[model samples]
Target: MERQLIAALAALALVAGCASPQPAPVQLVDQQQYTKAMRDNSSTFTWPESRKPDLAVLAEKSGPGRDRAPSGSERIVLEITNSCACYLGWEDARKRGDQAAASQALKVMDEVLPKFSPEDPDGQRYARETAAKAKAGDGSQAADYVANNCDSVLWK
Candidate 1:
């Protein structure tokens, strides 16, 4: 009975190890390496094709007031973060060879990027350059740009 119980526990452990996904690598040295790592382990995680966040509604729903409405500046920050999320998703999908997912992410990015307020020059530039790369079928530089510049807004 003791031997049987031990064997059963070992079998359960083996099954669990096989079923659980390995964690994504934490420290890639550069964008090219990062992209390679993501592609190699794309099956380890679910890459959701996210929608553009509606800033008006999001701002109205958050912040420090009874009305919970954020300031104009705060709203622009929200827009940048949300847009970057979509951008990252697009690049990630492209790396994974997932055309359908990449297209979905790009669609969201197109809708969100245009709405960035004129006050944000960096946001405008990122939108322009990344969108161009995405459409031009050269996503490597776009991914590198995002890694270098938009690291703050990148998803954890």
Candidate 2:
């Protein structure tokens, strides 16, 4: 009886251990990673080489006295490209059951969109609304936003 009791308790402990929830994976999305992801989506956009964002300058904008943020059509291209990448990351995370990654992508969007707001309010508004829709699990709006906005650039 003593041996049987010990075995049962050990089995119960093992089962409990297996049933515990594992911590979700860490998926931090920094600016460089985000920038690369944005560039990856650039195939969906049409912009002149001069207008494409310089990754080094983009990485520095978060720091003080960094006035290198793009303006005019360049700024618009950056906004549309980042928004396209972010929306895709958000939806992919949702599909993969990685809420942390989705939220991180949105956080990156929040960090990026404001820098463009002063120069291009309309583009910022569109990107902001797309992020909000992603937070609400409405990915179709993001798709629509990217499709309708990205391809129409005149690339001057």
Local distance difference test values of all predictions, in order: 0.50, 0.50
Worst 10 residues of 1 by lDDT: 63-72
| Regions of model 2 farther than 4 Å from truth | 1-75, 149-156
List ranges where model 1 is wrong by over 4 Å. 1-70, 120-126, 153-156
- lDDT tens readout by residue for model 2, 1-156: 122322343344455556779633323334445445445554554333323435444433321121212112233345555565566566667778887877787776666654554645776776677667666767777778657654432222
Q: How many backbone clashes does candidate 2 have?
A: 0
Error of 2 at 7 (Å): 78
Clashing pairs in 1: none
TM per candidate comes to: 0.46, 0.44
Error of 1 at 55 (Å): 14
What does each candidate score in C-alpha RMSD?
20.6, 21.3
